[model samples]
Target: MRITKVKYKDALIQALLFIYLIFTVYPVFLMVITALKTNAEIIKHPLSMPIKLNFSGFIKIFTTQNFALYFRNSFFVTVLSILITVFVSILLSYALARYKMKYVNPLSIYFLAGMMIPIRLGVLYINELLNTLNLIDSLIGLILVYTAMTIPFSMFIFMGFIKMVPVELDESAYIDGCSERKILFRIIAPLIKPAVATVTIYNFVPIWNDVYFPLIFIHSPEKKTLLLAVTIFFGQFQTDWSLVFSALTVATIPVLTIYLVGSKYFIRGLTSGALKG
Candidate 1:
C-alpha cells in the first residue's frame, strides 16, 4: 500500500511539471512560428502555423536595417562587461574570503548595500560621470556602466564559492613558496569554475537585453545595442508584427545559446556549495 501511494504522488508531481513546462515554452513556440508568417497572415490568424515559411523579416533586418551592427555592439558590451566584472569581483571576493583584515566586514557590507538598492536609481549620476569621462555616446561608456552594475552581485557569488574553499590550501601553497598571485590564480582559481560560469551567465542576460541604459546613453545609430536598435520597427500608426517577431527571435538566440552552453555549470554551481570537502 505504501509503495502504491508513493507511485501515485510521483506521477502527480511529474504531471504538474509537464504542464508548467508547456506553459513556459508555449510563448516562445508561438513567437518562432509567428516570425515565419507574413504580417497579413499574423493579423488574420495570430496563432496558426504559417502557410509557407517566410524568411523576409530575418533577411530584411540583416540586409537593410543594419541589424548586424546591433548584434556586434551587444556582443562587445556583454563580453567586456562580464570580463571586467569577473576579474574585479573574483579578486575582491578572494580577499574577503581569505583575509582577516579590520575592514573586511565593512567592505562586505558595502557590496551588500549596493545589492540591496537598484542600480537604475542612480542613472543620473552614472550619466554625469560618463559625460565627465567623455564616454557618453560610446560603447566603452556602456561597458563601464554594465561592469559597475553587475560587480556587486558577482562579488557576492564569488565570496560564497571562495569561502567554501578551505583556507588550508592557501597555507599549504604559501609554505611551498607560491606567491599570493600564484595561490589565487593557480591554486584557488581552478577550484571555482562553477562560480565563474554562474557569474558569467547571470550577468550576461541583463547586459545583453538592457534597453534602458542604451536608450539614455547612446544617441548614435552605430552604437545602439540589439534591443535598442529593434525599436525602429515600431510606428505610431502601425507596427511591423513580422519584423518585430523576427528581431525578437534573433535577439533571443544568443541568450539561449549562452545559457545552454553554460547550463551544466550553472546548475552545478547552484547545487554545489563552493569547494566544500
Candidate 2:
C-alpha cells in the first residue's frame, strides 16, 4: 500500500512537471512557427502551423536593418564586461578567502551591499560622471556599467568557491616558492572553474538582455545593442508580426545557445558554490 502511494505521488509530480514544461516552451514554439509564416498567413492562422518555410524575414532583418552592427556591439560589450568582472572578482574573492585582514569581512560586506542597491538609483550620479568623462553613448561606458553591476554577484560566487578550497594547497604552493600571483592563477583558479562558469553564465544573460542601460547611455543607431535594436526594429515593423517574430528569434538564439552549452557548468558551479559556502 505504501509503495503504491509513493509511485502514485511520483507519477503525479512528473505529470505536473511535463505540463509546466509544455507551458514554458509553447511560446517559443509559437514564435518559431510564426517566424516561418507570412504576415498574411499569421493574420489568417495565428495559432496554426506554417504552410511553408520562409527565410525572407530572417534575411530581410540582416539586409535591411542594422542587425549586424547591433549584434557586434552587444557581443563586444558582453564579452569585455564578463572578462573584466570575472578577473577583478577573482582577485577580490581570493584575498577575502585566503588572507587574514582586519577589514576583510567589512570589505566583503561592502561589495555584497552593492547587490542590494538598485543600479537605477545611481543613474543620475552615473550620468553626471559619465558626462564629465565624455563616455556617454559609448560602448566603453556600457562595458564599465555592466562590469560594475556584475561584480558584486560574481564576487559573491567566487568567494564561496574560494572558501571551499583547502588552505593546505596554498601553504604547499607558498612552500614551493610559488609567488602570490602564481598561487592565485595556477592553483586557486583552476579549482574554481565551476564558479567561474557560473558567474559567466549568470552575468552573460542579464548583460545581453539589458535594455535599460543601453537606452539611457546609447543614442547612436549604429551603436545600439541587439536588444535595443530589436526594440526599435519592432517599432518600425510592428505591422508585420512575422518580421517582428523573426527578429526576436534571432536575438534569442545566441543567449539560448550559450545557456545550452554551459548549462552543466552553470548547475555544477551553483550547487558547489552554495553547498561549500
Candidate 3:
C-alpha cells in the first residue's frame, strides 16, 4: 500500500512537470513559427501554421537594418567581459580559498557586499566616472561595466568550487616543484571545470540580453547592441510583428547555443555547489 502511494505521488509530480514544460516552451514554439510567416499570413491567421516559410524578414534585418553590426557589438562586449571577469575572479577566489590571512574574511565580505546592493542604484555615479575617463559611448566602457557587474557573482561561484578542492593537491604540486601559477592553472583549474562553466553560462545570458546599460551608455546608432537595435521594431501606430519576431529569433540563437554547450557542466556545478557548499 505504501509503495503504491509513493508511485502514485511520483507519477503526479511527473505529470505536473510535463504540463509546466508545455507552458514554458509553447511561446518560443509560437515565436519561431510566426517568424516564418509573411506579414499578410500573420495578419490573417495570427495563430495558424505558416503556409510557406519566409526568409525575407531575416534577410532585410541583416541587409538593411544594421543588425549584423549590433550582433557584432553585443558578441564582442559579452565575450570579452566574461573572459575578463572569469580570469580575475579565478585568481582572487583561489587566493581567498587557499591563503590564510588576517584580512581574508573581511575582504571576502567586502567583495560579496557588492551583490547585496543593486548595481543600477549607482548608475549616476558610474556614468559620471565613465564620462571622466572618456569612455562614454564606447564599447570599452560597456565591457568594463559588465565585467565589474559580473565579477562578484562569478567570484562567489568560483570560491565555492575552489573551497571544495582538497588542499593536499596544492601541497602535492608544490612538493613536485610546481610554481603557484602552475599549481593553480594545471592542478586547481582542471578540478573546477563545472564552476568555470557555471560562471560563464550564468554571466553570458544577462550580458547578451542587457539593454539597460547599453541604452544609457551608448547613444551612437552604430554602437548599439542587438537588444538595443530591437527597439526599431516598435512604433506608435502599428507594430511590425514579423520583423520583431525575426529579430527576436535571431537574438535567441547565441544564448541557446551557449546554454546548450555548457548545460552538462552547468547542471553538475549547481548540484555540486549546492550539496558541497
Reference-based TM-score of each model: 0.89, 0.93, 0.89
Candidate 3 — worst ten consecutive residues by lDDT sum? Answer: 231-240
Scored by Cα lDDT, where does model 2 land?
0.90
**Model 2, span 1-277: residue lDDT tens:** 9999999999999999999999999999999999999999999999999988988899988998778888999999999999999999999999988889998999988998887788978998888889999999999999999999989888888898899999999999999999999999999999988888899997888899999988888998889999999988788888988889999999999999988999886676556545643
Candidate 3 C-alpha lDDT tens digits along 1-277: 9999999999999999999999999999998888888889999999899999998878888997889999999999999999999999999999999999998999898988876677988899999999999999999999999999988888888998899999998998899999999999999999998788888888888899998888899998999999888765555114567777888899999988987888876566456534543
Minimum summed lDDT over a 10-residue window in model 1 is located at 268-277
Deviation in Å, model 2, residue 21 alpha carbon: 1.7
Q: Candidate 3: where are CA atoms >4 Å away?
A: 1-15, 236-238, 264-277
- Best model number under lDDT: 2
Ranking by lDDT: 2, 3, 1
For every model in order, what is the number of clashing pairs?
A: 0, 0, 0
> How many residue pairs clash in model 1?
0
